[model samples]
Each structure stands twice: as C-alpha cells, then as structure tokens.
Target: MKKLITVFILSLLAFTAYSQQADRFRFQMDLGAAAPKGGGIGALVNFEPQILVQRNLALGLRFGVAGLAKDIVYYDIPKDFTGEISANTSFSGTANYYFNYKKGKAAPYVGAGFGYYTFSSVNIESTDIDPDDIGNLRASFAWAPMVRAGVELGKFRIGAEYNFVPKSDLQNIAGEVIGQSTNEYFGFTLGFFVGGGRWGRFQ
Candidate 1:
C-alpha cells in the first residue's frame, strides 16, 4: 500500500508539471451585436485579456458595454411612442476552457464560462404622456454562458463568441422584463503573452 501511494503521488506531480509546460498564454477582444428579442438591437463590444492558468484552463477579464435601440410598435395606443434605448455601460469577468486543435501559431479553441452582467438604461425618446423616465435595470446576478471558436495567433488572438445572459428585470421600467438575452458580441483581441513558453497545455 505504501509503495502504491508513493507512485501515485509521483505520477500526479509529473502530470501537473507536464500540464504547466503544455499551456498557452493569450489575449482576446471581441465585437458584435447585442440584439434583444423584443424588437431592440444594440452594438456589443467586449475586450478580454486572458492568462492560461493551466492546460485547458484560462482566467480573464471582460470589459465592454452595449447600446440598444428600441423599435417598439403600439396597436391600441392613440399615439405611437417610438424611441430608442441606449443601454448604460456594463462590465463582467470570465473563465474559459480552451481546446486547442494544434499547438501552432494558429490554435482554435472552444469553451464556456459564467459571468455577471450589469445592465441599465434610460428612455431615449418617450411619448408626451410618458414622464421623464429615469429607468435603471438591475440584473446584477446574471448568468453568462458563451461558446467560442477562434484562432490564437502568437501573443494576439482573434475569435468570435456567442455569449448568452439569462433574462433579468429591466430595472426602472414598468413591466416585468424577466427573460434571457444574447450579448452577441464578437471579439478580436490583439495582445502578447509574457514568459515565452511552448503551447502544450493539452496532454
């Protein structure tokens, strides 16, 4: 039993070392559209700088914001209250798992992670009956799941990710706007990795 345990420990250490040696460092940026299902669309942009913590594991930060234009149509209303909504700036973080097909200059990967997105908005154009609406939406504890397939070129990386955030309330608004929405932001990142090492995080 003692010999078996010792061998197991040594094997674990070797695996860890191998894993570290096989990792790639990268930085990414993405831009796309934040299209809401409710006849609203916005420009979505995100910048992510990531550190390959280990094989298949990456830790990063995402900083971006979106501006949504409202295209609402009223049927029973006397006057049409058509206006656009500019979503306030919001932020979030990310952790991803990269599956690099090859350990070359161009490595393609796919992974997913959870995020917390903050959304806020004010009435861009309101009808005459609509008061000076100071709307603030709070979806603080939001879930962000994303799937990305992109190529990593040396210290710079470029790819597109389809990020989805679960439906939350559009704060400071009248009506329960609780549902899921898509971030629709595609990233094109350009940054270099420190501590030059071989990309071999895949064992």
Candidate 2:
C-alpha cells in the first residue's frame, strides 16, 4: 500500500508540472470483465468518478466490485474427496491517479493504485459435512496495480481499464490457508466530464 501511494505522488507531481497547458476538467464511467489468474471468470462492471486537476494529470476514486463464479458437481483432489462448489464474489475500492497525454480530441491515459478486496461466498461441499458446515471466509486486503485508456468527444468520453489485484493470504476459512493465490480484474468504461473553465483538464 505504501508503494502504491509513492507512485501516485510521483505521477501527480509530473501531471501538475505539465497541466497548465490544457483546459477543462474530465470525468468518466467504465465497465469490463475481470479474470482470475489462478481461477474464476474475469467478469465485472466498474463506475469510476474522476477529476482532471491538470492537463497532463487527473485523480479519482474507483468505487465498484469484481465477481467470479462457477458450479461444480464433483471434484478430484489428493483423495477421492469431493462434493459440490458453487459461487464466489470479491469486492474492491481504491484511489487512482492518472497521467493523461493528448492531441486535439484524442487522449490516452494510464494509471495505478492500491486497494482492498473482500472475498466471500466460497462454498465447498462434502457428504461427510452437514449443510450447516458451510461458512464464510475472511476478507483479504492487498495492493493492486491498474491501467486505463480513453477517448474524449465533446463533453462525453468512452474508455476501458484493467485492474490487477494480486493474491495474498490475509484470512481464510481454514485459518490462514497458504498456496491459495488469485487475482481480480475490471474491463471497460463509459463516462462524462464538466467544469474546469477552458483549461483543458482532460488533455
């Protein structure tokens, strides 16, 4: 998390130094799919609220969640042990800093940040275990890196982004299980912007 903050500060300084050359503030909304590097479907939708403080720089908060699910009737593990696994979802939020570059109406941007995600609804079944044996898993808080790009048309904008959340073991149903790692992701977005007078804010 500290590392993520350090990067954001450096990017903010760089954008501030070059933002005086542009006009107008920028905003955006985005949706996309997230796939787990180890397991789970890479499906998701994201709505990001952003403010372009400078022509070359912007800062915003990403408020949304990512989910992964699959249905299994049987399993083959170290033993013949198996039952049924249903679905799971992960939620995340973070502060994002973007460095934007542009010419005329086209703008491309990239960003990175850190956030926390909660993993829930991970269920496994076995004939030896009762239905009441199922329980919720604890949440994991970790550092994540994200990247995004977009285009500006008038007061409206369209873009997409991919957020990568690394795997970390903060808590688990089995009391801190190890060797279980996964990733979370976000795909595309659509958004709008207002204010900042005539100084290209989203430039």
Candidate 3:
C-alpha cells in the first residue's frame, strides 16, 4: 500500500505542475464495479486529474485500485477455496478526445491509456485447513492497455472501460509457477468532476 501511495502522490504532483501551464484543469473521482474475464466481481475506484490542452483534447493521469474475489476449485479434489485472489494498483497516462464541446451539450468521448499494473500477493483461506499451511501467492507486473468510451453530461460522466493485461504466471515462495491468470477486466464507472475552467471552451 505504501508503494501505491507513493505512485499516486507522484502522479498528482505531475498533474499539478502541468495544470499551472494549461488553460483549464479538471479533477474527477470515480466509483465502479468490475467483472473479470473469468468469473469474478470486483470494486474499482479512480482519481483522475486532467488538463485541457485543446478545445477537444484533454490529457490526464489515472490512479486506480481494484479488488477481486473468486472461488477456486480443483478438478480431481473437491474442496472449497473462495477468497480474494486479486488486488491491484494502476497508474496510467490518458488522452481523450471529445466529439462535441458545446456547453450543456452531451459530449461523447473515446480515450486510450497505457499503464503499469502491480498486483498484490494474496493468501487463500480455507475452512478445512489451517491458514498457515497455505503459502502466499504472488503475481507479476504487466503492461496494461485500456480503452474507454463515455458521455459527459454537465458535471457528471458515465463510462465503460476495458483493461487488457496478458496472462501472468503466479509464483510461490520457491519461485515455482503454480498457476497462470490475467488481470483483465471490464468496468463501468460513474464520476463527477469538481474543476474545469469552463464547460466546453478552452483558453
């Protein structure tokens, strides 16, 4: 969590420095739900700081957290293993282009971003056995590409996004590959922006 905080602070500072030079700034907070490719549900939260670089173009940094839980079952053995399997922090740079920039008019936007995703280690707990016997599961970092489309109405924005992360092998304390899984997910978000110099016009 400390590493996540440090990355967020650095990204925020970068946004602040760029905001001073830009004509307009926008800050957005988002809460959403995510569904992974397999069979799991997760919660997502994001903080985005953006600057309008042009009338229809904006650049921003996205700091996000996601936590997912799912059930794991073995084919030969019948056992119940259900717990949080994935928790991740993401930091990305984004660029968005708005189709319509008229005030009070709904603006549709399509955006893309690239980022690094850091997944935390998770331990699976089972009621049948002692938790200490189960080893910690570690996941690797991957480069994630994101694509999103959204509509901004007044100060509120609704969007859907897809994250593409390749499958990464999970490792144990002995550095042996135990399983392979991807962190890819689809998310729907509702957000509100607090600051923007003007609704549609850029200075």
Candidate 4:
C-alpha cells in the first residue's frame, strides 16, 4: 500500500508541473459596453497580455479605451443638460487570482489594478443654450484604481469591472471652470484568449 501511494503522488506532481508549463502566457481581447455612473451607455475594448506567475495566479497589462455619456454639473448655474460625450483611454497593470476547483473546467478569478486614465473634455449641449454656443469641455488625466471579478471557461472569459476615477473640472473653450463630471464607470466584457492551456486547476 505504501509503494502504491508513493507512485500516485509522484504522478500527480508531474502532471501539475506539466499543466503549469503548457501555456505560460496568453493574450486576451475583450469587447464590451460601459455604463457610466449617472450617465448614458458607452462601449469599450481591452487588449491584455498575461503571464502565469503560479498555479493560481496570473499577471497582466491591460490597454483599454472607452467612451461614456455622463452629465456635467455647473457650480454657478442651474443647468438642464441634454446630450453629452466623453472619450477615455487607459493603461494599467493587473493581477488575477484564479480558483479552479479540483480539475473543474471553470476558473473563477478576482483581480485589482491601478492605471492612468486620459479623458477628453466632455461636450454637453444644454437644451437651454444656443446650438453654436456649445464648447468642448476641457478635461485632464487622472490615476485610477480598478477592481474586477470573472469566470473563465476554457478559452472564453466573462468578466465585470469597476473603475474608480477622480472627478474632473469641466472647462469651456475659454478655459473657465464651468462644472464637474464624474469619470467613473462599470464595464462588462465577453472575450476569449489564445493560451493558458486549458483552465482546470488539476487535470
């Protein structure tokens, strides 16, 4: 019985090493919609390159871009806003921890990241203002934090993330501070990856 157990343990260890080395790295592409806090719907795309650091941990760098339609709040004037748009681009370093239970095909993960975000000035045309009077709201770059959770089944990945971004001052073409707009958003994604050699914890 002791001899049999020893052989089984060795076999398991070999298999585990093989699994980890099969695909040490992978690339992922995700396309999804973003819902801004107190704003209209938008879309985003993310490109990530990931390296497996351990059996249950991976590290990645994400390049992402998104457009959101959020409101602008004026400090002096009581404004009734109508249409709005803001463009955002970001680059972040991320780490994911996976939970693949007992060779199960599905791997669930939670992760966190911090990135630099660039925002284009939001343009909002109030129904009360003149049509040609619309000025591009000036914006600035910010450093933000992100949190995400997801499940990966084979090559396909489904995930959701929230970006905590700082609010920026809305300035007109004259460079006068007019109001503020929240740059935070929630994103949902459905995409697939090219590596990581089958997502089971032990198989």
Candidate 5:
C-alpha cells in the first residue's frame, strides 16, 4: 500500500512538472474490474501521465495496481487450495496511436508496452489434517509484456488490457517449491481524466 501511495504522489508531481505544456500534457486515470486468467475476479486502477509528441501519438508512463482472489489445484501433490489472493503492481512505458482522433471527440487507439510486474506474497494452506501445517509462502516479481486497445471520448475512457505475466512459484520456509500460481490477467476499464485541451489531429 505504501508503494502504491508513493507512485501516485510521483504521478501528481509529474503532472506539475509538465503542466507548463498544456497542449502536450495529459493525465488520465482508469478504474474497473480485473479477471485473472487462472479464474477469478477483482478490481484494477491505473494512473498515467503522458506527453503528446504528435497530434495523433502520445507516450506515457502507466502505474497500475490489481488485486484478485483465485483458487489453485495441484494434481501431482494432491493439493487443493482456495481463497488465494494476489495483488500486483506495475510501472511501464506506453505508446498510443490514435485513429482519426480528436481531443473532444471520440479517440480510438491501440497501444503496447513492456513492464515489470511485482506480485505480493500469498498464503497457501494444506488441505491435510491441519491447514497451518504448511508455513507462509513468499512471492516474487516478473518482467512481462502487455497490450491494450481502447477509446477515449471527451474526458471519459473505456479500454481493455491484457498482461502476459508468468506463473510464480510458491515457496515455503525451506525454499522448496510447494505450488505455482498463474499471474496473467485481463482488465476492463472505465474512467475519466483531467487535462488535454479540446482539439483534433486529423481533418
């Protein structure tokens, strides 16, 4: 949570630093639901600060956080787990190109980015006689690629994104692998932003 706050503050500071160039500065936020590829659902939120280098092209830094609840089943070890909550954070460089886009009108875009994903530690319990027999597990981070497509109409945005994150191993106190958790997910967003004057790129 502390890290999330720090990143948000940095985003605001970025806006302040670049606010001088109103025509080129853009700050947008998106909030909506997230569905894990492994089979679960939760919420997602993002803050992006951008610079419009060209009328139809913009580059930005995206900071996002996602949380989900999932269940993992291991056939080999005969492990059946439930209620595993995973939280992930990301910071990435994004480039978006608008098609027949205008500031106040509908702005349709396709985007791509590469980023680092940090997954939070999760607890995996043993379905044996006692659940506490197994110790707590620690989570590790991964570097993954992502893609997004969406549209921005006036100050509102609706988009969809996919994160191609790798599976993470759950390790116990002895550093032995107990199980694996799927980390990839899909996010749907509906949000609004402040900034970017009303204008159009193409005639």
Candidate 6:
C-alpha cells in the first residue's frame, strides 16, 4: 500500500511537470450515491485533481469514500442472528479521454482507474451468540478497478462509474473464513470544476 501511494505521488509530480505548458489544472469535487452489491444505496464523495496534458487527454488522482449498509437476518436455526454489513473507503488514480475538447460545448468522456480499497467487517449481533464469541471480521486489502463515463458542460460535470472488487473471504480473529463478500458497486456523481488554460481555440 505504501509503495502504491508513493508511485502515485511520483507519477503525479512528473505529470504536473510535463503539463506545465498544457491547457489547465483542474480541481473537482463530486458528491453522489453508491449502490454496493446486495446492499442499499449509500453516499459517495470524491476529490480529484487533474492536469490536461493534451487537447483531449487528462491525468488525475482520485480520492474517494463510499459506504454501504444492509441488514442481515439468519433463518432456519433455532437461534436468530441479526446485524448489518458496512463497506467504506476507496481511492484510485484515473486517466480520461474527452471526445470533444471545445469550450462552451458539452464534451463526453470515458475513463478507467485502478486503486486500493479497504472494507470493514460484517458485524453480527444475536440473541443466541455470546458477545465473547464475536470477534473482528475483517477483509484483506483489495485491488479495485473502475470504469466511468460522463459529460462535462462548462464547469459542471455528471458521471457514473462502476467499481469491481473481487469476492473476498471474511476472516475472524482465529483466521477462519466465515463468509465472503464482494465490494462491487455503481456510483453516480455531480461535480463542479474550475481550471484555467486553453484547449485548442477555446480558452
């Protein structure tokens, strides 16, 4: 994780240097919703800093957090178990390509990102199980991949993205696999961005 963060920072520095003569540096904030697999809709937030290195290409770093929660109940047993599952904190680096780079006109874009994700464990509380038997149920660090598409109009942007994190086994304090979960979700965002520079004839 440390190595990955280091690499992202170094690459951002290099890109910033290379974009010195480019069009603009963009800073954007996104607020949206996330729908995780088997979970209800949750809130999502993202902060991105990007530099346009070309007429149609931009490189950026994305830091975001999303949370999902769902209530669970166990049946078919004499003892009843009920609790909730929560997932949070995702960060990534992204590159986007704009189809039309004209100012004052809406430009549609597509992008992909890769990053590290951490998720909290499923917490279960039941009338039958003792509190002592409940231990931390944690998930390992997961490699996440995402794809996004959006339209940018003037300073406003709206987009949707889907993140794919493979199924991870949930482990207890005894290192026993008790269950498995996948951190896959779809998100929609609305953002406002500010930047200065010229892309072609549009300033």
For this target, which candidate reaches the highest lDDT against the unseen true structure? 3
Candidate 5 overall lDDT versus native: 0.77
lDDT, model 6, position 2: 54
List TM-score per model, in order. 0.55, 0.56, 0.85, 0.82, 0.85, 0.78
Q: Which stretches of candidate 1 lie over 4 Å from their true place?
A: 1-26, 70-93, 101-103, 124-129, 133-141, 170-203
Higher-lDDT candidate of 2 and 5: 5
Candidate 4 vs candidate 6: the lDDT winner is 4
Off by over 4 Å in 4: 1-22, 131-134, 201-203
List clash counts for every candidate, in order: 16, 19, 0, 0, 0, 0
lDDT of 2 by residue, 80-127 (tens): 222112222222333333333433444445565545444543444456
lDDT of each: 0.49, 0.46, 0.77, 0.76, 0.77, 0.72
lDDT of 5 by residue, 95-184 (tens): 888875343578888998887788777765555524454467666788888899998877788999998988887776688777788888
Candidate 4 clashes between residue pairs 3 or more apart in a chain or in different chains: none
Give the higher-TM-score candidate: 1 or 2. Answer: 2
Error of 3 at 203 (Å): 5.0
Better of 2 and 3 by TM-score: 3
lDDT of 3: 0.77
lDDT of 4: 0.76
Q: Model 1 — which ten-residue stretch has the worst lDDT? A: 178-187
RMSD of each candidate relative to the true structure: 11.0, 7.6, 2.8, 12.4, 2.9, 3.7
C-alpha displacement of 115 in model 3, angstroms? Answer: 0.4
The sequence of per-residue lDDT tens digits that candidate 4 reaches over residues 2-83 is 4333543564455345445567777788989998888778899887777777777877777788888766686656863643
lDDT of 6: 0.72
